[model samples]
Target: MRAIFAALLGLTTGMAMAEMKTEKVEYRDGDTVLEGYYAYDDAAYKGEKRPAILIVHDWNGLDGYEERRARELAALGYAAFAVDIYGKGVRPTNNAESGAQAGKYRADIDLFRSRLNAGLEALKARPGVDPARIGAIGYCFGGGGVLELLRSGAAVKAAVTFHGSLATPRPADAANIKAKILIQHASQDPSVPLTQLGDFIKEMGDAKVDYRMIMYNLAVHPFTVPGPQYNEVADKRSWAAMKEFFLENL
Candidate 1:
């Protein structure tokens, strides 16, 4: 079932007006130091506060894909920060390594949520960011990370996940969610089956949270990424949907 956001499909972030200023931001989660990518249009909002968006990377860890998305968000007038979940210099080179790194957090929800919250805290502390008007978006594993942000009851107004993991060990924590959610998923994803989607819908319903889930038929896992699983239609539509969601919520 499509939610009330189907009309937002045509909304684009528009052309870039100025050079985006980007940098590597170093922050921490407890004793673990992390390095994230931060981008913003300094020409548009110099010394002025704006809503910020936190981006979580896929299973392979923070890389060029996530950073490019940060710049896109920056062009859209948001202070975007692409968060690092695997700590500084912990990027994984292949699926095996990425899965191993992501597995550690999956098995430990506390650490997963903490790392996400740490990123949120870092984004909130950045200059010219309005902490109250914050949102988060994640891709694949990172998508699950943003949902964890909701489950952890982080102070964010919006959360979006693209082809993310739907099952959470603590489904009861859904009640703690304080943000509106948008989920972009693949209808034919082998990694995430229909049963999982059903359970997730029920979890959100039981928690009485506002949420929307869009399914792209025939698209597989990680459909948004520009690779074998890439679904151009799904990627563009989902991104447009997110932009509209943030424009309204944040």
Candidate 2:
């Protein structure tokens, strides 16, 4: 009987896993072929459109991490798209390559913005997505990506960044931005120094932007990911904060 019960449990889990649907989506951005993965709850969204969330990847570009995040959002009843910032199926495995790719885009901010806009358009065009209600979340390099989107006056309702840099080479006009912003920062993050954070907060205050900056006292860079750099407590708290922010704004 115990063995039979175990077999039943395994079967149930497998069925649950199978119910999570994922698909590869490709769209044209000018002359470039952009690619990404779309995920959602197949059972819940069968007949109705759902709120959509765009997942922007780090400097590594589109990879397993962002795809998994999309799945998590889908389980929460959202149509989530893991956006591609580095063209179709391109992922950098090492710091050297990642830096090179990131630097190339950073050197020409307009081109970078165009790529992100393309991803947003793709998400908006999806059949089951509520184009008017959209949110975006990004990590590391992608974290900065979402900020750029918000700065560009995209139609996003909410934007969240995890361990993203706060400095923008071209400062945004606060009046142009319409989205409610949530920035999750690691207090001990070496890359984004405390002084820079202070300046960012001051700039936001001066601009009169509606924003919230949460600093995890003990967290370091990449605190949310469950990899080597993850901080379990900070991750939980930040996710809870994200959920609340999305609920209120998105």
Candidate 3:
């Protein structure tokens, strides 16, 4: 009986894993070939459309971290796509490379938005995705990308950023945002000063935008990232907040 029970448990676990589908998707931004990670629950996608979420990667590009997040979202019954901003095979292996690659896009918001929109288009075109109920989330550099996507007047219903930049070259463009926004930040983050948060709040307010900002005290930069800087309490709280935000808006 013990052996039989163990066999049944293994089968169940295997079946559960089989229900979730994940793949590497090759896409494009103009002539640039971008590879993104797509994941969804096959059992939930049986000829039915579901809300989708676009995930923007950090400066390191499309790596395991983003893929894990995509799978987590897929488990939550939403189709998740982790986009590539550095083009195919352009992942940065070190801080210097990451800074340069991320900085290049930061210096040119137009180029950044264009790449982001291309990812959005790819997400919309995926099977079993409801284009109208789409949302976006970003981390670090990707968090800034999500904000840019919202500012670009994309049809996304919601946007969420974790430790992303609040400064934009065109603050006046906030008037173009059509989605509700959520900003999750580390209060002690030296990279993003409190003044920047104040300015961002003013920008959103001036545009009469619907948005909310949450600050996690004692947390430094990349609090959500799993490492020495990771704050367990803040990470859990921020993720829960994001889940609620997407549920309410998307």
Per-residue alpha-carbon lDDT of candidate 2 for residues 190-242, written as tens digits (9 for 90 to 100): 98987878878877887788998888998999998778889999988988898
10 residues in a row with least lDDT, candidate 3: 11-20
lDDT, candidate 1, 119-224, per-residue tens? 9999999989999999999998998899998999899999899999888999999999999999988887887877888899999999999998888888888888
Please tell me which predicted candidate would have the highest lDDT against the true structure. 3
Q: If the candidates were sorted by their lDDT against the true structure, best first, what order would they fall in? A: 3, 1, 2
Off by over 4 Å in 3: 1-18
lDDT of 1: 0.91
State which candidate, 2 or 3, has the greater lDDT: 3
Off by over 4 Å in 1: 1-17
Q: What RMSD does model 3 have? A: 3.4
Local lDDT at 247 for model 3: 93
TM-score, cand. 1 vs. native: 0.92
Q: What is the TM-score of each candidate against the true structure?
A: 0.92, 0.90, 0.93
Q: What is the lDDT of residue 54 in candidate 3?
A: 99
In the range 76-137, model 3's lDDT, one tens digit per residue, is: 88999999999999999999999999999999999999999999999999988999999999
lDDT of 1 at 33: 97
Runs with alpha carbons beyond 4 Å of true place in candidate 2: 1-18
